[model samples]
Structures are given as C-alpha cells and as structure tokens.
Target: MNLLEAEKFPFQQTRFTRTSDIQTIIKLFSQFSKEELMKKNQEVSIAGRMTGKRMFFADLTDQSETIQLKFSSENKKFAELDNGDIIGVVRGIVCRTDTQEKKNERKLSVEVEEFSLLSKCLRPIPSSYYGLSDTEERFRNRPLDFIVNKQKKEIFFLRHQVIKNIRQFLEEKKFIEIETPILVSEASGAQAKPFITHHNKLHRDFYLRIATEIPLKKLLVGGFEKIYEIGRIFRNEGIDARHNPEFTTIEVYQAYENAEYMMNLTEELFHYLAEKVFEKEKFTFNSHNISLQKPFRRLSMIEAIKEHINIDFAKINGLEEACQLAQKFNLKLEKFQKTVGHVILAFFEKFVEKNLIQPTFIYDYPVEVSPLAKSKPENEEIADRFELYIGGLEFANGYSELNDPTEQKKRFEEQSKQKELGNEEIASFDKEFLEALEYGMPPAGGLGIGIDRLIMLLTGQNSIKEVIAFPQLKNKEKNFE
Candidate 1:
C-alpha cells in the first residue's frame, strides 16, 4: 500500500497486548527448546522494519537489533509484504531454529500468527551493499547517513554524552550555566567579523555574536562569581577542515582568578573528559596518541618562536627591525601588521603553531592580538594569555582579563584604527563594554573552548565538519540530471 493509504488505515488505533524488543526476546529464549517454548506458551508482540525476505521467512530490524520471522505458507498477509515495510506481529511464539550441524549452535526466532502493516516505504534505503560512500551526501543527508552507517550514529551519541559530562563537571564545581544574547548592537568580544542583519522595526543593523566573552564578563561585573555560556557563535570567515562559519563554543569566566589558575583548570577539565569518555588518560587521534596524564607543557610565545625559528623576538628593537626580520623570513604581512607586536604574531602563526603537536599551553601573547587580555607587568607588550594546542590544532584560549577601563579603551581605539585600515576581523570600539569595565569589574580569568574541535579530537575524527551536525555547505545550482 502507498504511504497515504497506510496513514489512513486503522492500525493507529490498534494496540498490542504486550511487546518486547527483538534482541531482548531473542536473548530470553536463546536456550529454550521448541517443546519447552511450547509448554511455557509465552507470547509477545514485536514490530520492526522488514530488511530481508525469502519464500517463507523474513528478517526485521529495529535500531541495531535484528530477528528472523517464520511464517506458514498459507499466511497471505506475510506473502504480500516487501522489504522496508514496517509491520507488527501479534501473539508471536519464540522458538529455536533447527540446526543439526552443531548441538549448541541453535538460533532463536519468532513465529508470527497474526500480522498487520504499520507503514509502507515508497523508496529503497541506501545500503552498504550499494555503497553510500559519498562524503557530501553523508553530511547533507544526515538522517539517511545515520540510518545506514552505525559508526556515524554512534559518534553523535558520544557527542551528546560529552556535552552531558561537561555540564555535570561544571555544575559540580558550582559554576552557574547562563545564556547571553546572540544578537547584539556590537560584536566586541573577539577579533572576528560578525554576520550582520537589519532590524525592520528599528531600522538599524544588528550583528550575530562572534563570541560570548563580553556579555559573560559583564555578568561577572554584575556580581556573579563564576559563570559560563555554551552557545553558537557566527563568524563571517572562510571554512576549512578546521574552521566553520558557525560553531559551538563554551565561554567560561571566573572572578578573582588569574590566567595560570585557568590553565590548571583547563588541564583538569580535559583530563576528566578524557578519562570519562575514553576510559583512559591517553587516546589516539588521527594516528597520534595524546596523553592527558602529564601536565600540559607551557612555553612563552617568544620562547616558542625562538625554539622553532632560532630568533629572539626580544632583541627586535622596533617595528622597522621586526619588519626586516619578517622580510628575512619571507613572511607575508598584512597592512595592520606593521607594529612590532603584530609582526611577532604573524611570525608565530607562520613558524610556531604547527610545531606544537601535543597538549601545550603557548602563553604570553602579544598585546596587539589580545585586546581583552591583561598585559604582563614586566613586559608591557606581552599579554597574559595562553592558547591550548593538541595535535597542532588550537582547542582553547584563555587569559587574565583586562579590567582597567582606561587601558581597555586605549586597546579599543587601536582596534578602531585597525578597522579603519580595512581589517574586517577587528572588532569595532564598544563603548558599553568599556563603561561596564569602568564600574570597577574585578580581576578575572576567562576561557573559550571550541566544542566541535574537542569532539573531533576525542572521537578521532579529523575534520570539524565530521563532528558538527548539519555543518554549513556550499550552495550549488540544481542540475536535474
């Protein structure tokens, strides 16, 4: 029958007296003989999608369980069924299949007495035999992908468990989960371009948030001691294996804490996640075995650059000197990267980031790149910031937040200058955020972890799109071939 006729049928009003899962029923009667099963007279109602059929027998599956259905030749209802059809069997007897080759190798099956069609399938499902191997098709048609591929379905199930464990861990530490606005007048949190939309009523352009940092910190100023927000962030950027325009991030903030405290907390949290998810402190990702057992290695940005490129950035006297060094290393420079701090960052990105293969905290970022981070007291040009890297991918960024209103204002002004110089990723000056800082916000430590990349690492998936459900894809015109 067609789907329309199946929907109009009276099967919706019909109820089964008792039903057990196919796998459960099979396990319960695996050792029972045919005479024993008949003597006990246990009956059950079971339903599943028909996967295979022969002359007088059929195979049905629900989720990951499968069972064989035996029917008499006179059963007209069983004769008319097709593969992929959903059907229910009533008062089916459980019996062991006949096997003369081995005494202990008998299989359990169901004997259907009365049956009814619950639904009809119009199209055949994509099968492993026919090959559902296209990556684009798998991502675009996630429901079908899950139905066909057991491993892909398991990954998403693990994703759910990962988020649950993270929430449990945070709540155990008394961290209050909170939400911030996704639409804002200004996206001042991070150095990323925001997606803009026009409000019809207000006749003003609003931005989708690029980061949850500013609002979460504002909550800290509003008397909350510890707070976190797990939400979607949008950045008008290019997409790659490691980057997506839309992504999930968990931004955490704690008052009366420094960057070092945040680093330790991050390590602890990762360790906890590793042990809970993988049942060990060491897990393999993309062929690399990573260890969360030891303390994550820590190195200053300047020291890392020195170790990788044999150049002491401290000796670079001025912007002209840094520019000369960049030219010497054949590094490409952006228009706004003329300052010494900017040049150091460019060099670090080109020469230092990939060398950090294991879990390492690369700290002491240049002040130019870290607008919201507090500057180091001994070296004013460096900020007390650390970025966690695993298998050469950045997983977390945390820093001692800059609470001085005057310094923050100056940094905002500098960012405004960068914006004027056509730096689209630089955030515009946010007067309201500076005003909140003016209200004497306490010293704090804040962190933003890329949830998708973390999942990819934990699940051994290499691409960010593999971990994200319904990741953005390029638009294509229909060919209708």
Candidate 2:
C-alpha cells in the first residue's frame, strides 16, 4: 500500500492559531525597528525556534521575526523555559547587543515578562550544519527542511512569484485561466507513460493525465479563443535531478495562431517575468549572462545543429545513414532507429544542447516526434514545432496544431504503431479528442511550459527539487507498522 493510503484517516479540525494569523504579532513588533531596539533598548518577546541557543541568552527566530530571550531563574517568568519551547508573551524592547566572545554578533534580545508554551518539542531537531543529508528524508519531511534552510524557502517563494507573474501576463493578454481533469481514460496529450488506477465505482481503469494539452485543445475546439491551464501532471518514470514522478505544467492554446506567434509570445512572457518577478532584467547561468529583453535569438533546428555540430541533418535522408554518422560522433543511437528526425534530435542533444545557455528558440522538429503538430509545407518530414531553451534547459514546447482530421488521424495511427513497437512513451490515442478535431479545430497554436523547470531556472536553482515544495519521495519504512 502507498504511504497516502497507509496514512489515511478521518479529516479532523485543527485547533491552534493558523500560521498566517501571526500578522498581529508583526504589528506588535513594528513599534520598534529591528535596528533601533538593538541600539537604544534591548527587549522583545516572540515565538520562534531557538536557532542559536546558549547558557545565559538565546536567539528565538519565529515566522514573524526574530528576538532573543535573556533568562534568570530568579526572574520567575522564565523559570521553566528551554530553547525549543514554542512560547508566546510580552518582553522588553528588542536590542542588538554583543557577547564577550563575539563582538560583532547582531541579536534581538528580550527580557521575558510573560510566557506560555504553545507547543513543546520532545525530539531535538537535527543541527543545520549536518542536517537531513539524505535526499529521500529531506523530501519526505520537507517542512522541517524549509524550517532549517533559509535558501530553500526563498527558492519556493521565487517559484510562487514566477507563477503569479505568468498568470498576470496571460490575463493581461486576455487568456482565460482554466482547469482540466487529472484522471482520464485516454492520455493523448503528450508522449509519456501514465500512472493508472482502478475506478472502483465506474468499474474502469483511468490514467493520470500526462499533459493538459488535450483538454485545453478541446476547449479551443469548443470555441473559446484563448485559454490556459496550470495544473499537475503525473508520469510513471524513473526519478532524477531533472525529473519527478509528478510535476506541474502550464498549457496554453490560441485560435488561429501559428507556432511562430506562440514562439514570440513565450519569449515576451519569459522576459516580462524575469524583469517583474525576479527584478533582474538579465539572467546569469553557467558564466553566460542572457538578457531577457525583446527580440530574443531564434534559429531553425537544422541551422542550430549545423552551427554547433558541423553536420548537415538536411542531407541525412535515411535513418541507417544517420545512425552511422551518430556513431562516428559518439551520439546515442540504436541500430533499429527508424526516423531521421530522431537521429537529428539525438545528435543535437549530444553535441549542441549544452551550448544553448542563453534564451534560444530551436524550431522545426521532426514530424515523427510531434504527432499533433502541423507538417511544414516545403518539407513534409518536419513539423512546425519549436522549443525554447534557456540556460541549457528546455523551458517550453509549442507547435501549430494539426487541425485537419485526416492528418490528425494519420499521426495518431503512427503513434499507435510506435506504442505497439515497445515505445512506452508514445501517446494513447483519444478518440473523443480526434472526433473533436474532426468537428474542425481552427488553425491554432498550442504551448506547454514545464512549470517546475521554469521556476527552477528563474530561481537560479540547478535542481528541480529546490523549487518544488514537497516533491515525491520513496515510501519510508515505518517501525510502527
């Protein structure tokens, strides 16, 4: 059984003051500036962890603010106090004072007047210097990690700002923010394996959605011109620093717009977010600073590959020849590789992906990899798809949707063949979605942004775990069980 099921219990009410209501405490402390209290008078009372505790005095850092507590057994009020006790009360003015050992220590000292313990700590929290080194434990008990590490908290805060700014940008552009189902019968949005569970009442199995693309597209087919959904998607895959079993993605679609328009829109959105949310007009990654200003660099897929790898993918007409070339360049390729586009992708990823530290749009992917996108007019082998990369990370993928019912069916059939041929990530065809497209989905553009990856980039966090609040972790063995 999963941890979620094992921990299932009847929902109960909470009694303590919720975390947010501490604003009253903030207001009370606002009477004295943190600096003024340190200089003129040294007094304050607050509820916080004893981050740094000592014999005579200790620093209490709370969610609202930080203040120190000076204790004496004769003082009666603090006779029963300890470092980790969650206390509440009134104290003298908060002051900054130095100790005999360290002269430069800045502290908010409080002379305890009244006190009460809201909660008591039995087990000591691990020391921050050697705290929660194991990755699984850290993710499982994430709230404690946030309490111990300040940088982790800041990264998530920046993530919220990124999402907020994106919402504002889309709303400003008249894009309606909508929601889609997480459980579905057909997961035709993207190429990924899904987690499936039995629907007891329905007597059927439903898979978790891998992407919001299909449902959002259904809305577009239903006559809504512009819409977007920022939601959770689940994929059954191996975990790594860059991948999680469950993550967030934002999908947007606009009626009558091509992939080119979406490319421009994505760049504008990212630039606006960097300037507004991050408060930094330029991004520095891997020693290269990329300015998120208007008119970002854009290049055709073939052109980018050619510039970096010195290879002409246009001339590599067959998969067999492409595989030979990849082998010469030490790229990952199987002898049974069937698509020239797949070979181009493998070659670019091996040789050129790391060089794209700045914001760059690589356009015109192989049609084999983009089942729902329109094919290029001049070269039917290529699809009108583009992916935006920043700091060597693929942030967004968009394409001009294949609206013609016949072409859409043919692509789905190809995808079905791939699925049958042991390609576990190939999408399972959704007949209803295809039927909706048959009703004539207008020529439109669709985009899916990896929200977690975007947040990681904006927050300057190299690992996806840093940006996610409670990333999925392996089930821990419970001794009680």
> TM-scores of the models, in the given order?
0.89, 0.86
lDDT of 2 by residue, 304-391 (tens): 9999878888777687788788779877654324678888888778777788887889998989888899998898899999999888
lDDT per residue (tens digit) for residues 34-146 in model 1: 77987877788998788777788888777647888889889876766777777888668887666556886655778888877876666777653454688989888886676
Output the number of the lDDT-best candidate: 1
- Which parts of model 2 have CA positions greater than 4 angstroms off? 1-46, 76-79, 90-92, 95-106, 128-136, 284-294, 330-336, 474-481
> How well does candidate 1 score on lDDT at residue 101?
63
Candidate 1, residue 9: how far the Cα is off, in Å: 3.0
Residue pairs of candidate 2 with colliding backbone atoms: 37-95, 38-95, 38-96, 43-92, 43-93, 43-94, 44-92, 68-108
**TM-score, cand. 2 vs. native:** 0.86
Top candidate when judged by TM-score against the true structure: 1
Error of 2 at 33 (Å): 8.9
Q: Report the Cα RMSD per candidate.
A: 3.5, 6.1
> Model 2 clash tally?
8
